[model samples]
Target: MKKMFAVTALVSAFSFSNVAMADEDIGCGLGTMVFDGKSGKVHKVLAATTNGTSGNQTFGITFGTLGCDGTGTITSSQKLAMFIDGNMDNLARDIAKGEGETLATLSEVWGIQDADKIAFNAVAQENFATIFASENVTSTEVLVNLNDLIAQNEALASYRI
Candidate 1:
């Protein structure tokens, strides 16, 4: 009796959750594809359960399969932040020197074309003190300062992410 009651409670919870969620709340997964366009509590619960248990959601997110957008994992700004965080020392050195592979990579990350890379590098070199600003400046601070500097540069303003 107790086991049956627990099962009933769990099912009830799932049903209530279905009501609370929007119609498209199941998200992209094998379950969503399987139960596409279906409605009601039972279908919602089954779809939710399948998506949660099968690990297809993880696969979908990683590989851009199962109707998931490939670009959902990280925004462009996030990519810039991660790159800056990982390559801070190299970036600083390159910025200070006004040219290096890392600095070139940074320009690429901002989608600056080859034609404008010279201006980008020049801006970075010219504003190195403003970008670094302090001995303990953080990656986030560096990104903000870099974006600000880029925005101020007429040739590289469009490249600011």
Candidate 2:
């Protein structure tokens, strides 16, 4: 049981270390957001030390793959990009229709004022082709592309998190 205790302790320590780094992770590339509701540097060492040749299950188990910096100091464009990635399919369909519950969720998640959700939805719908060029897009790709579209619209650029 001592060996099991040691393993648990090590994992706990590693988890805490990563969680601790989320507070000041701005502009330092991007770190994995940990389960503790904080952002921290992605520790590739977990996979290395575990002595396994499997997929990135260790990292996925410990850290969420949302690609958010978790510092809560991100710009409006970045948050919108994250929203796009999270609500990709539903958002895409909503954009095509120019309205939906999913779009409302995106507006809520972005903290957009109720009065502005309609305009924002309209802008997103107008630029759906640019935002979602293809079905297969990476999170970073979504971020960059969404930011470009946000730049063209005043309402989107006004909402920042």
Candidate 3:
């Protein structure tokens, strides 16, 4: 239908506009990585945290990935944080698996490197998310390597597009 076609075109235009407006390279340079469509200037990233304490016995962890675009350049970096309350090993495993998988996928998409992954920082903090609050949990940070991401792109150039 003509109406349907018009709506689709409008939606496509809006989607591209939003993508163009997104903060370049989120979760990288700044203290707190900006989430998609978040409107705010990020001058400096002083600190960050991620905690997963939903219930006394329930198991879950808060995970976040931040990337930032270098000033006036395409160069960027990313920091990933995961907060765990149940088992430390479980948390590590989750990061190695769940978060790791996502990071790898993102690296390929964003042209990041594997060796660039590093523990950014960690600190104990008290986080109160409505009913669930964590008092003594350490927030860990992980950085993504940009060079490796580029190599991946080079290797997979043919498959891309």
Q: lDDT per prediction?
A: 0.76, 0.57, 0.29
Please write out the lDDT profile of model 1 over residues 17-43, one tens digit for every residue. Answer: 432222244666556656767888789
lDDT for 121 in candidate 1 is 88
Best by lDDT: 1
TM-scores for candidates 1 onward, in order: 0.56, 0.52, 0.20
Model 2: clashing residue pairs? 22-39
Model 2 misplaced stretches (Cα beyond 4 Å): 9-83
Question: How would you order the candidates by TM-score, starting with the best?
Answer: 1, 2, 3
Candidate topping TM-score: 1
Q: How many clashes show up per model? A: 0, 1, 16
Candidate 1 achieves a global lDDT of 0.76
Better of 1 and 2 by TM-score: 1
lDDT of 2 by residue, 1-161 (tens): 99879855654555555433332212121223323343333443331222223222334333532232333456665666666756778877887888999888877776779988888788778888777778766546655665566666776686633
